[model samples]
Each structure stands twice: as structure tokens, then as C-alpha cells.
Target: MINAFMQARTGSTRLPNKVLKNLQGLPMFIQQAKRVQRAKLVDNLVIVTSTDESDDIIEQLCNENNLLCFRGSLSNVLSRYFHAELNYPCDAIVRITADCPVIDPELMDYVINSHLKNNNDYTSNCLVATYPDGLDIEVISKNALHNAYKYAEKPSELEHVTPYITSHPDKYRLQNIQSEQDLSAYRWTVDEPKDFELISSIYENLYVKKPNFNYQDILELLSHKPELNLLNPQIARNEGMVKSLKKDKEEGYE
Candidate 1:
């Protein structure tokens, strides 16, 4: 069974409680979860959040919405993911973050299929980043996740789940899914207030017409209204990972 673990927390440094921010009357993460449920290949969807007291609301929100929730370490997200799998066993794990409210289920299934077909230790779309930032997906084998959990030492590796595995490619088989057209220029992730505005605008424009709007639908909408892209411009991708890497250097892990 393939379990998709969506890492979420209310303690975002960029935008605190950002996942709890509402989009179209529902909390942002719930909206993302709804989209993730549309993927046919994902046998189960689990919300993996830190056990910090601040995240009590996240668990309550999950319970209120009838979504599965697992609680683990607040700082070490790799530990959170590892323990989540221990509680809910699966053959492979799909890693997702709650910030991407506009994540594409079709894209997720595509990556999952590739992971299974290639029998890769790790498979993801973001390694080369052909897709938009918000559409990133990572499929990790049980063995790979276990190895990463046991061996990862750097602050960056521990904070972001797959960095250790990705860094040591020789130890694991890896595959990256690329889009035919380069769409990395677009950003649909919610990291700041401006990003939320762009996501809200996208949902306002597309969700009413098709609740299950794919990335293509978003692209089509953006094609006519290019101004939406300006809402959250100049923000770097994976800012959290960058910060963690800096911490790793400070701690002499680099």
C-alpha cells in the first residue's frame, strides 16, 4: 500500500499558521488534502504534523474534517515522517507539504507510477524542477526512508526529509519526472501573504468552474491573466531548506 504523508504544522516561520488560513471558506491545508484525495494511486492519505502544543489545533482540524492525523517531533521532520510510517505501515511513502493548496493530483499519480515502475529508492518531480514549485512530489521506498531515518545527521537532512538520500545518490536509485514544457517559472505555493493572495485568486477564478482543477487549468487561467503572477514575485523556492542548510553549516555539519 502507498501512503501519502502530508507534513503540516502551524509554526511556519515565514507565515505562522499559514496552513490554517482559509481559501474559499475552507482552511488551506484542507483544500490541499481534498485535491490529494483525488489521486487514484494513493491508497491512503495521512496528515503528519508535529506534536508541538501549537499543532493541537491542526489535530483538532483533522478530527473535525474526518482526516487521519499523526503527531511526531516538532523540529525534526524526518523523525516525524519516520514515526508516521511506523504507526501506519506502507510499502512506499508519498511526501507532501500542506503549503501547496493548488497541488495537482494527476501530477502526483504520475510520479507515484514512475516510482513503482522503476522500483526506485526515491522518485520525485522537484529534483530537476520542470513543474511549478507547488506541484512538487516525492515517492520514497520503505527501505530508503528507513535508511534516511537511521543515518541522516545534518540539520538540513533532518529538517527536510529526503535531503540525505538525495545527496548520496550512489546509495539509492533515484528518478526525476520532468515536464515536456518547462513550467518552473510559475509558483503556486503559499509561503507568504502575497502567495496566499495569488492562490485565493486562482481558486476564485478556477475552483467554482471545476473543483478538481488540474495544473493545466491553472496554466490556462494564468495565460489570460498574467498579472496574477505578480502577486508573489521574487520569492526563492525551498527557502526553509536553505535556512536549514545554513544552520547545518553553523553546527559544522557541512
Candidate 2:
């Protein structure tokens, strides 16, 4: 089975309850789940969250939407994915985040197909970041995931799932799916208030006409109204991961 797991929590320091925030009249994560469910290649879809009380809201969102949910470690996200794998057995795993409400299911299937065809231990579209940050997708063999769970020790590696696997490319076969054009400058992720503004505007402009709007539609919208890009350009990409890594180093971590 190929289980697609999306990790969510309500404890984001920068944007608390961002996942549950309303978008197009529904919680943001639910919108993301709807997009992910359109994947033609994935066999199962699961929302993985933490056991913290704050995350209970996430679980309830999954329940109300009738989507599969798993609750695990609050901080150790690698552990959460591992447990989610155990709950819904699968030979390969697709890792996604709740913060990305605009993820493309077609791009997801492309990554999944490439991962299997190349027989890669791990694969992703963001390895070199050709796609926009929010559309990132990662696929890994179950055996490789087990190795990451057993060996990853650094707090950053454990908390940011797939870092342990990608950091050590020499230990695993890796592949990156790149876009024909370099559109990495666009930031569609919902991490801060400005991000939500841009995303909400995108949904407002396109969701009504095309409920299944894809990346191309977003690019067209941004092209037509270039001012939309200004909404969240100030926020750096992967700010949370950068903060975690910096914190680890400040505390005397190597």
C-alpha cells in the first residue's frame, strides 16, 4: 500500500492554529486533504498529528471530514510518521504537510511514479527546490523510513521528518522532480498571516470557477495580477526549519 501522510499540529509558534484556520469557508488542512485525495497513485491518505491537547482539534477535523487520522509524538515528527506507517501499513510513504493548501495531486503522482520507476530510497520535488516551496513532496521506501526512525538523533532531523534521509544522500538513492521553469520564487505555503492572505486570495479568485485548480492555474492568476506576489514575499521560505536548526546549534549542538 502507498500511504500518503500529512503532519499537522495547532502549536505553530509563528501562526498558532494555522492549520485549523478557515479558508474558503473550511479549515485549511481540510482543503489540503481534498487536494491530496485527488492523487490517482496513492492508495491511502492519512492525517498524522501529535498527542498534545492542541492537536486534538486536528484529530476532530479529520473525524468530521471522515478522513483517517493518527495521533503520536508532539515534537518528534519522525516518530509520528513512523507510527502512522505502522497504523496504515504501506510499502512506500508520501510525506506532506498541512500547511500546504495548494498542493497539486498531479505533481504528487508524478513524484510517486518517478520514485518507483527509479527505485529510489527517497525522492522529492524540493531537493533542489525547482517547484515552489509549498508544493514540495517526498516519497521514501518503508525500509529507508525504518532506518531514519532508528538512526536519526539530532532534534532538527527528528522534528523535520525526511531531513535525516536527505542529509545523507550517500546512504540512499535520491531523485528530484524539477519543473520546466524555475518558479521557486513563489510562496504558497500557509505559515504566516501574509501567506494566508495570498492563499485566500488565490482561492477566492479561482476556487469558484475551478474547484480543482492546479499549479498552472495559480501561475496564471499570479501572472494576471502580479501584485498578489507582494502579499507574502517578505517571509522567507522554510522559516520554521531554519529556526529549529539555529536553535539546535545555539544550544551547543554540533
Candidate 3:
């Protein structure tokens, strides 16, 4: 079974108790989990939180929803993920954050299908699609995760999560599924106050009577109201390391 495992905790330094923050009468973490389960691509979905004291609320929410949940080290996320893969019956694991409210299930299916079709060990939508924020998806074989658990030695790898597995192109066959329709300017993931505000706007406008619709339905609604993209102009970018490396090169550090 392919598992979409979400890593979440209340220890977020930037926004404390952000996951417990309500999005239309529902906790943000729970809402994100529901979206993952609703996705057509994921065979099974599990919320992976930490054993830290702050994550108690996450554990309770998981129990109430009857969703599979795992708790492990707060900092060493790679180990937490590996433990989840071992406990769950997952052949491949999809790494998803608990902050994405507008995660595209169709795009997730595309990434998983592309990985298996191309016989790649690692695949992701963020590698190429660049569809704003909420559409990020990463699929990696269980073996690759185990390899990361054992071999990844850097503190950044333990903290920031899956980069070690994807960075080694020689060891893992990495593939990216690009969006053919060109919807790269959309924002859906929740990070800061502005991100949460943007996602709340989408939920307010789209998820009124029917809170459960696939990605295509979302696109149809969003296309008709193109101004929603302006809800948050500064879209989040996951290219921090790349940007830092470029700066280093300019400063003669590389």
C-alpha cells in the first residue's frame, strides 16, 4: 500500500499551536489529514507527529478521527518517517506536510504514477511543477527512506526532512512531474499568518456546502475567480538551499 504520511507537531517555533488553529470550525491539522485521505492517489493516510509534550493535541485529534498516527523524535524527522513506514503496510511513502489545505490529489496521483511508470526511486511535484504552495508532493520508495534513516548524517537532513534522499541523484533515480496546464501561480499551503489567511479565503469561497472535491473542481472554481491568487502575492518558495548556495558562490565561499 502507498502511504501518504504527514509530519505535524505543535512545536512550531514560527506559529505556536498553528495546527490546532481552526479553519472553518475544524483544526488545521485535522483538515489537512482529511484532504490527504480524500485524495484519490493515497492508498492509506497517516498523521506522523512527535512524542513531544506539545503534540498531545495532535494525538487526541488523530484518535477522534480514527486516522493512523505515529509519534517519534521531534527533531530527527527522518527516523520518525522510517518508523512510520515500518509500522504501516506501505510499499512506497508520500511525504506530505500538515500545512497544505489545497493539496491537489490529481497531481499527487500523477507523481506516484510517474514514479512507478518511469521506474524511479524518488519523485516529487515541487521539483518541477512549482504550483504555488499547497500542491507539493514527494513520493519515494521505502528502501530509499530506510537508506536515509541509516546513512543521512547531517543535522539539516534530520530537521528539514527529505532532502538527503532526493539530493543523491547517483543513488536514487529522481523524477519530477511538471504541470502541463501552467497553473504555477496558485497558493494553497499554510505557513504564516498570510498563508493561513489565503487558505481561509479559498475555503470560504469554495468549501461551503461541499468541503470535499477533487483538484479539477478546485481549478474550475479558481479559474472563474482568478483574483484569488492575489490573496497572497508573496508565494512561498522551497529553494532556500539553492538560493543560499548561489549567494555563497557570489561571495567566493563555493
Candidate 4:
């Protein structure tokens, strides 16, 4: 089964409980899932979260919304995903994060189709990233995930949950989906206060008018009002991953 395994937690230091924040009346997590559910290629949508007490609310939210939920290790996310696939019948595990409420379902189907057509061990939009940060997508075959679990042991690999497979590109048949335009400069992920402001503003301006808005709708909105980009342009891409990599070296997690 093709499962979109969304990773989330309530322990974000930069933006505490950001997943639960309201986006057009629904929590950002729920809103993101609502969009993901529309992907025709995805067989099931599941929330893969941590087992920490703080994350119990995530499971509760998933229960209320009728989303399949799985709780595992807090820090070792790679292992969590590996086991999630084991317990659930996930053939193609579509990796998603809860922070991206602007996720496009058609784009998700494109990524999944690419994975199947290429017969790749692992495929993602992030490898050569043409999409904005929050729109990241990763589709890993069951074999690829099993291999990652068997070989990856570094703290950053465990924490980031795909660094192992992504790092060892030579070992895995990796495919990167890219857009014709290099739109990498855009930042749509929610990691800080400014990010939340940016996302909330986007929802306020677009959600009510077009409940199922896609990338074009957002592009048009931003084209008319470029000021939205300034809300969090200062933040770098994968700031959390960079920090984890640095901390791993200092704390002897290598």
C-alpha cells in the first residue's frame, strides 16, 4: 500500500506546538492532511509521531480526524519510519512533514508516479529541490527504508529520517524530481514566528476564496503582493537539520 507517513511532534523548540496552530479554522496538521488525502495515488494517510507524552495530543488529534496514527522513538525518526512500514502495509512510504499546510495533492501524485515509473529505490523532490521548502516530498520503497534502517546510525541520520538514504546516493537508486523553474528561493515552511505569520497570511488571503488552491493560485497571489516573501526570507533552508548535524558532532553522537 502507498502510505503518506506524516512526521510530526509537539516539541519544536523554535515554534512550540506549531502543528496545532490554526490555519483557516483547522489545525495546520489537519489542513495539510486534508490536502494530502486528495492525492489519488496515495492509498492511505498515516501520522508517524513520537512516543513522548507531549505527542499524545497528536495521536488524539489523529483519532478525532480518523487518521491512522503510529507513535515511536522521539529522536530516532529513521527507525520510527522503518518500523511504521513494518507494522503497516506500506509499499511506497511517502514522507511528509506536518508543517506544510500548503501541500499540493496533484504535485504529490506527480512525485509518486515518478517513483513508480522510474522504479527507483528512493525518490524525492528535495534532492535537487526546485519546489519551496515546505513542499518537500520523499517516496521510499520498502526495501530502501529497510536498507536505511540497517546501515544508518549517525545522530543526524536518525533524527532527520532520510539523511542516511539521501547521504548514500550511490548505494540506492535515487531519483530527484525537479520543476522547470528554479523556485528554490521561496520559503513556505513554518519553523518560527515569522514563518507562522507568513503561512497564516497566505491562508487568510487564499483559503476562503479557493478551498483547494494549488501552486498557481499561490504564485498569482504572491505575484500581486510580493511582500509575503519578506515575512521569513531571513530564515535558511533546513535550519533544523543543520543544527542537528552540528550538535551531533559536539555531543559525540557520531
Best by lDDT: 1
Which residue pairs does candidate 3 place in steric collision?
134-189
Candidate 4, position 70, lDDT: 93
Q: Candidate 3: lDDT of 211?
A: 84
What TM-score does candidate 2 get on C-alpha atoms? 0.97
Count of backbone clashes for each model?
0, 0, 1, 0
Candidate 4 stretches with Cα past 4 Å from truth are 251-254
Q: Give the TM-score of candidate 4.
A: 0.97
Decreasing TM-score order of the candidates: 1, 2, 4, 3
In model 4, which range of ten residues has the least summed lDDT? Answer: 245-254
Query: Can you write out model 2's per-residue Cα lDDT over 1-254, one digit (the tens) per residue?
Result: 78899999999888889998899989999999999999999998999999999788888878999999999999899999998898899999999999999999999999999999999999999989889879999998999999999998878888888888998989999998989999999999988899999999999999999989999999999999999999998678888789889977987777
The TM-score values for the models, in the order shown, are 0.99, 0.97, 0.87, 0.97
Candidate with better lDDT, 1 vs 3: 1
- Candidate 2 all-Cα RMSD: 1.0
Q: At residue 217, what lDDT does model 2 achieve?
A: 98
lDDT for each candidate structure = 0.94, 0.92, 0.79, 0.90
Candidate 1 residue-wise lDDT, 99-163, digit = tens: 99999999899999999999999999999989998999999999999999999999999989999
- Error in Å for residue 35 of model 4: 0.7
Which window of 10 residues has the lowest lDDT sum in candidate 1?
A: 245-254
lDDT of 1: 0.94
Off by over 4 Å in 3: 216-227, 239-254
Q: What is the C-alpha RMSD of each candidate to the true structure, in Å?
A: 0.7, 1.0, 3.3, 1.3
What global local distance difference test value does model 4 have?
Answer: 0.90
Q: What RMSD value applies to candidate 3?
A: 3.3
Candidate 3, residue 184: how far the Cα is off, in Å = 3.2
